[model samples]
Target: MALIECKDASFAYEGVSVLEGVDFSLNAGDYLCIVGENGSGKSTLVKGLLGLKKPESGQILYGDGLKSTEIGYLPQQTMVQRDFPASVYEVVLSGCLNSLGRRLRYGPAERERAESNLERLGIEDLRDKSYQALSGGQQQRVLLARALCATKKLLLLDEPVTGLDPIATGEMYNLIKLINLCDDITVIMVSHDLHEAVRYATHILHLGRRQLFFGTSAAYRESSLARRFLGRDRI
Candidate 1:
């Protein structure tokens, strides 16, 4: 079964429609990339999917036993977030907050999970370092580790490589691909880089004012829609 399905989903803010007639299915282990122009409602669609905002019409179904709390999210960073005053360990462990329910403190399992994620991201040595002291790439790795503490099933990333250098961006993309391909996690990402979208994503959801295309990346490469928007750039 599909992990998530959006059936004619539409979203609006203060009754001004931003996205409409969105339909798609994300199967388990699919690396789905959402691509569009700046004002094409990509972020708004993500909010609707994450239940941070409700759709104005239609349905978003979570199948394959998926739940909102079980999905990991790495949001776009702001200047304030970049300078957040906290230890790496503290920031990573906070990903467990949603799953803590009424608990006042983290249990052993949560700590273990946090540590494991740190190791997985090759940042275990930096666990005690101050978050604000790290470089942009290091900060993103810490955040990814934090998100991993939330779930192993699915990950949602919004422009994860936005401000990094090319080397850092490539490293981040490889790490995300490892999570999707090796760790067996499903991925849904919102990205503006069409080149990276074509190179890394298995499925593409190209959103215009509406959903212009939704299909496998291979299909998108052959479609006229891709031609018009992306030109004839080879993946």
Candidate 2:
């Protein structure tokens, strides 16, 4: 069964429809990119997928033993989050909060998960450093590790590469690819970089306050939607 399925779903905000006609299916290990301009309901759809908001029409279902609560999420950071005063280890270890359930304190298992994720991302050296003290790329890596600590099956990222340099952006993309392809984890990402989205994603779901196209990356490249949005030269 697919890990996630959006069956003719739609969403609203304050009694007004912001997005409609959403549909897609994602199996394990698939990397799907959601592409659209600002105000196209991408974030609203994400909220639905994360179980934070209910769909106004149809449903978003989870199968293959996956639940929306178990998905690792790396949301776009605000200025306040960027300067959050906490140790790197503390921040990353907090990802295991969901796994604790009724437990009041983190146990060894959660600690080990955090350590494993940090090592997986090759950031063990910065374990004791302050999270706000790191560079943008390093902070992103730390956050990725934190997200990984939360889930082994899937990741949901929103504009993860937003305020980074060219090199840092490339590094972040590579890390995401590694987590998706090598780690065999499904990835659902919302991105503005159509070029990179085409290069990395297995499937593309284009939106314009509604689903415009949903298909393989190669097929998306050939679609008129791609031509209109990315241009032939860009694709």
Candidate 3:
């Protein structure tokens, strides 16, 4: 069954269309990578999925039958985020806010869950350190641990490896693959690099101002979409 469904979705800004006639579904444990140029509405689509923006037309249906709190999101980490004063433990623990809400105290269970998530991402040692003090790779892992604390069923990561070095990007991709393979988490991500997205994603969503493409990796490889947008040499 589909976990997320969008039908005839459309969005616009200042009377200019951004997304139109977008229809797609995400099943449990599926990994979908969204690729597009800077102005192609990739970030807008993420906002739409997160309910941060209202679509001009159509609807998004979450069919996992989960509550709104169950949706987990990890947005791109910008340079400014490097200075966030929170400790790794504190940031990861914040992910439990949707579940814990305004609770006066976090009990043993919540603490355990946070620790386990950190451990799963192999960053348990950094839990007590300040988020601002960690290396780029460490910081991303910490944020990913935070997202894992939100939900195990679905993970939405937008431009996750944007500013990392090549080695860090490769490590991040390996971690993402392991998260999907071992934990069965459905991964939906937005990316600018076609090669990286194709290397890891099972499904691809290509967005243009007035056009888009959605298909499995094999199908995407077989299509001419790469030649037009990514160039033949890159493919």
Model 2: how far residue 228 lies from native, Å = 1.4
Q: Write the per-residue lDDT of candidate 1 for residues 1-235, one digit (tens) a residue.
A: 7899999999888989999999999888999999999999899998988888888999998998888878899998888987788999999999988779899999999999999999999999999999999999999999999989998788999999999999999999999999999898999999999888988999999998789999999999999988877777554
> Candidate 3: where are CA atoms >4 Å away?
none
Better of 1 and 2 by TM-score: 2
Q: At residue 194, give the lDDT of candidate 3.
A: 91
Q: Which candidate is the best by TM-score?
A: 2
Model 3 pairs in collision: none
Which 10 successive residues of model 3 have the least lDDT summed? Answer: 63-72
In model 1, what are the clashing residue pairs, if there are any?
none
**Candidate numbers, best TM-score first, in rank order:** 2, 1, 3
Residue pair clashes in candidate 2? none
Off by over 4 Å in 2: none
Sort the predicted structures by lDDT, highest score first.
2, 1, 3
Off by over 4 Å in 1: none
Per candidate, the number of residue pairs that clash is 0, 0, 0
lDDT of 3 by residue, 1-235 (tens): 6888878788899888988877888888889999998988888888888888888989877886754457688988876888989889999998877778778877788899999999998898898899999988888899899998888688889888877899999999999999998888889988888988888999998888644788798788878887676677777
Worst lDDT 10-window in candidate 1:
226-235
Instruction: List the global CA lDDT of all models.
Output: 0.92, 0.92, 0.85
